[model samples]
Target: MRRITTVLLDVGGVLLLPSSEVMRAAIGHSGIDTTDEQLRRAHYAATAATDANGGPDRVEVYRRTFAKTCGVPAEFEDAVHDLLTDQFTGYTWQRVAPCAKEGLELLLAKGFRVGVVSNSVGTIEEMLATAEVCQVGGGPCAAVEVIIDSAVVGVRKPDPRIFHIALAEMGADAAETAYVGDTARADVDGARSAGLWPIHLDPYGDCPDPAGDHDHLDRFDRLCDLLTSRSGE
Candidate 1:
């Protein structure tokens, strides 16, 4: 264990884990005529790609991304648009659960600098509002120093570049900062690449193995325990 200067967080499974069932319902309702594979491709681009603030143009990003998979006629553009919008609109932030809020409050109050490293699109503010996170406009989330949305910052995770941006914003030494995220390649690999330790969460049992030393958690409910203990140790 090492002294912690900052704690970077992931949004998707770490903050407000989306309901796959709910998202599927929205995509199905969009009336996009496409095969199963194509539909899945389109859905991911719309939701995942937009998570970061600055990246590819929205329309072309998804349109070209899903084109190879869907291979739908020119009409796929309209369908992709409808399906993505519907999916984002269906995002649910279960406030009562509050895994991130609980951990964030503990980190901030303990004097550990905190920041958000989430990939989002459309708007991070909207997601935070739904999640009830108080970091809106950089005031602080129960004491978390700052939140950097990939979309807001013009970058996204898995790029390593975005993590560098987050570290710079936090003014934290890479060795002293730990990034906790759910996705293996995107979060864990990205953190490792950025020279930050990684703590991976696998609540739903989907997390994968990593190549080097790392810690994995089954549930985020005890995240506060992990961070606080890490800093003290």
Candidate 2:
């Protein structure tokens, strides 16, 4: 509720998306036909399903939900899941989200301090740079204050400690910071636990928030608007 000045984003679903080529290849191999738009919707839905399930087998949940959302027949879902399991890698998440760079630029232009806090395998910084999304310092892309990878920090999200690390690095106050991410279990809960406002990037309206607790953004432009409005308050 406080005026937002600092924004921390999750890398995977917020700025970087799964490679369309990789997803299409996997779906094709499974004999399922899907358009690029469908694949994008499926990715968000899959993450929502993972948040709903909240099980230890997150990868399996995500793949299965993705397969189902891609229109794979129930009988072929397992096969598609298997195919995804083999094909989906950390490198497969290389596509920068549409308007991601512009969104960051808009935030920075509006005087918002931006940074990344992702649950990844330590390659996110390079991946973001290669994708031309954002980086820790000045470059072709937007310059963020810090990039916190869970693997590098030895702490994962849904853990306030990880958010604290980013906050400390940015010299940001939790009340005036917003954490934007794609999952409820990890992003919303973790940010709330860390005393930061949580904003879920639910582009497809797939995530169910019965409590109506956190903010939801359907697009990057909406994020710019939300933060600008909050800062004005």
Candidate 3:
């Protein structure tokens, strides 16, 4: 509402997603068959479940939710979860979302500063580069103002400190910036607490948000539409 001039993004789920190849391989190894579409749905379902749970055991919640969403039987759930954990512990999260680059380009074209603030394992910058999404400076990918990784910053989200780090680096005021992320607890609540506009990326329409405390977007293109419309106001 304050006229967003800066846009900070989360890496996983927003710009990048878990590698489908890795997911398929893990599922196949577990003797369970699945399709790309199902895997995509499963990822969002897992995130939604984690948001609803809002507990510290997020990894377990995500695993169990993903297994259930993927139609894994009770007996095979643990095995699939373990396999997925082993397969996805590294660079498997680098698969760039389809609309990421275009979305960033649209933001840049509209004269908005862009950056990243993600809860990652210290490799988000490199991973974004590898995925050709964007980076801190000019490159083949969209050039953003900064990238703040929580692991490197020694602060995680739902804590205002992490968002502050990005805001400081970008020299952007919190009220004039928007943080886009997938989960409600980490993204919406965190950004709101940091005094920034929080936009939740709910591609699956899963987040209930009965109180309607923040904005929700079904896709990156919808985000572009929202910002573009706001810019005109």
Candidate 4:
């Protein structure tokens, strides 16, 4: 196997983060009385929105579910999407981990092709634009070479095809490429199955790689350490 020349990452939980406070505040502002029951319902709906069956259109998820939870019929898609966006992606993107950004820059400086391969059922481009990550016409693609969004691609992970697409698009061999994400099934196992090195990002101090090698970590600061520790960098 050759040394790695490409690095793939999962966005949402890693980059976007999961903010409970943000969600609570947004739902409270919806005038929908954020009760315990409402909280549980909202969580369920949000989780379902990510899976395969919920079907991508984030506005539909919020419009239908929020309406039911708030006991309202419906609202315009723009209004609903805006509401949901406030809850989920409303975080200040500038506050992202400096270590994460540094690690990315380090990888890029090492001449490694970087990209994002996320499991998203919503319009990722919209989210990217909202987060100030340029997505059109060769703008800021440096952050992540290409985004393989599930909503747009209509395909989820744990599938070899997704990894194959990434490897091909980046012009890198699977043997030399690597994927870093938080999920065990999707990131580690899937990357291994695709013949790429799997680096699980376990923030909770748990290792999910199953090999017990201790490559799992809490932050992206150690990314260079992992990539360079091996034959790849």
Candidate 5:
């Protein structure tokens, strides 16, 4: 394991996720009497269904599953979709990971270049800005130097080429880069395909073998420790 020079991260689930409470509240606001437990179950169900049967109609699949699991009415299906999809647009609706900003600062302080590689709706930067992650000490933080958005670039994750785009932007080699992501297929597999090391963030320990086989960190701050361990090796 060579010393890593750059760290690439996924946005949703890694840095920011729609908080469970927020999701429940939003659904409740839409006149759906859903529980936090139901939402969590549906969240995993949506992911698993998407992984099992992938298609362009993933949102529909999630909607159907979520609505069924939460006992949401057909009328509230549209509301559920809208809230989940647009949660990032409003700061109050998102849950910024406790370790994200700190981890970015740690990487920058350690002289490692950091960037965000997300499959978002072309609002990755705006979301980060809204969360005030782009600022540190009232100044712009150079910690995150690049943000490669799939929507803007017309390429999404699980495509190794997207990682190449970020590598090119950073002027770094894949051999010395590490991509941190929560999803096994999109982030871990994709990063591996691009010739970079893959680290999985398995907070819940739900991912099974192979996909969850790589180095695992329960939190982003632990990434600094992993990097240090690599440096010593």
Candidate 6:
């Protein structure tokens, strides 16, 4: 697993996420009777299509992937895509993921340099502040050293340049850092390219790839456990 001094995380799925109930409702409006579990699976699958050209066409990428994964017909694809995009982009439809604060606090407590590298729409930093992420948790806590946003930086995932930007900002080397994200193509693919160890936050273990190709975490809080076990090994 190599030595890890810095821990970088993706914001959308790892910290801020669309409300599951809202997503279900949106998909239901398109006449698809899907469960929250299905929506989540589709969500992870959809994010894979988000690549370097992820800004303006973000909604379209997610739309196609989600509809296909959920088996939505062509007749309802447009409607479902619109509704899903509305849910993901609108702040009113987004909520902080559970254990996000606790996980960041744990990483900071363990002396890890933490930062955020997100493919965002220019408001991620503000959103993180609103969610109270990476803030002082009653006492001293680890602060995020940098936030590399695709919108602001003009570089998106699947391009190792973005990750390198973050590593440079943190004054850390790629081998000493680990990037945790939800999307396989964008996060894991990009992190590995930038020479950082990649960890996928796959709570449901729905990754289509074979097991053991990359480290996986079912929960954010469990990251501490993985790091602890690795250091001991």
TM-score, candidate 5, is 0.76
Residue range 1-233, candidate 4, lDDT tens digits:
46777888876545554344454455555455455445444433433343323345744664455445544334543454465665555232222332555666677787778887877766555565555543533655345667787766777777877888877877878887888876665667678888888887765443423357535756686777778878733
Decoy 3 TM-score against native = 0.95
lDDT of 6 by residue, 50-132 (tens): 54235677668877787778778888888877877667564532567767888987888888888899887787777777766
Stretches of model 2 off by over 4 angstroms after superposition: none
lDDT of each: 0.62, 0.88, 0.86, 0.61, 0.74, 0.78
lDDT winner: 2
Candidate 1 C-alpha lDDT tens digits along 1-233: 57767878877656764444443444444443454444444434433333332355754554344443344456544664466455544244332223567776776666767777877764555666655765644454454556677777887778888888877766788888889886666788789899888887765443335334577765565765776687785
lDDT of 2: 0.88
lDDT of 1: 0.62
Clashes of each: 11, 0, 0, 0, 0, 0
User: What tens-digit string does per-residue lDDT give for candidate 5 at 11-106?
Assistant: 776787656676776577567766555665555555545544557886677556655567777787777767666652433325576587888878
C-alpha RMSD by candidate, in order: 7.3, 1.3, 1.4, 7.9, 4.1, 3.9
Candidate 4 local accuracy as lDDT? 0.61
TM-score of each: 0.65, 0.96, 0.95, 0.64, 0.76, 0.80
- In terms of lDDT, the poorest run of 10 residues in model 1 is 89-98
Candidate 1 vs candidate 4: the TM-score winner is 1
State, as a TM-score between 0 and 1, how close model 4 is to the true structure. Answer: 0.64
lDDT tens per residue, model 3, 1-233? 67778999988889999988888876675677888788889888999999998889988999888888888888888788898888887478867886888888888888889999998888898899998888888789899999998889999998999999999987899989889999999989999999988899988799957757778888886676787676566
Please identify model 5 stretches exceeding 4 Å from their true place: 19-22, 29-49, 52-93, 135-138
Better of 3 and 4 by lDDT: 3
Q: Rank the candidates by lDDT, best first.
A: 2, 3, 6, 5, 1, 4
Which segments of model 6 are wrong by more than 4 Å?
20-25, 30-42, 48-61, 64-77, 90-93, 135-142
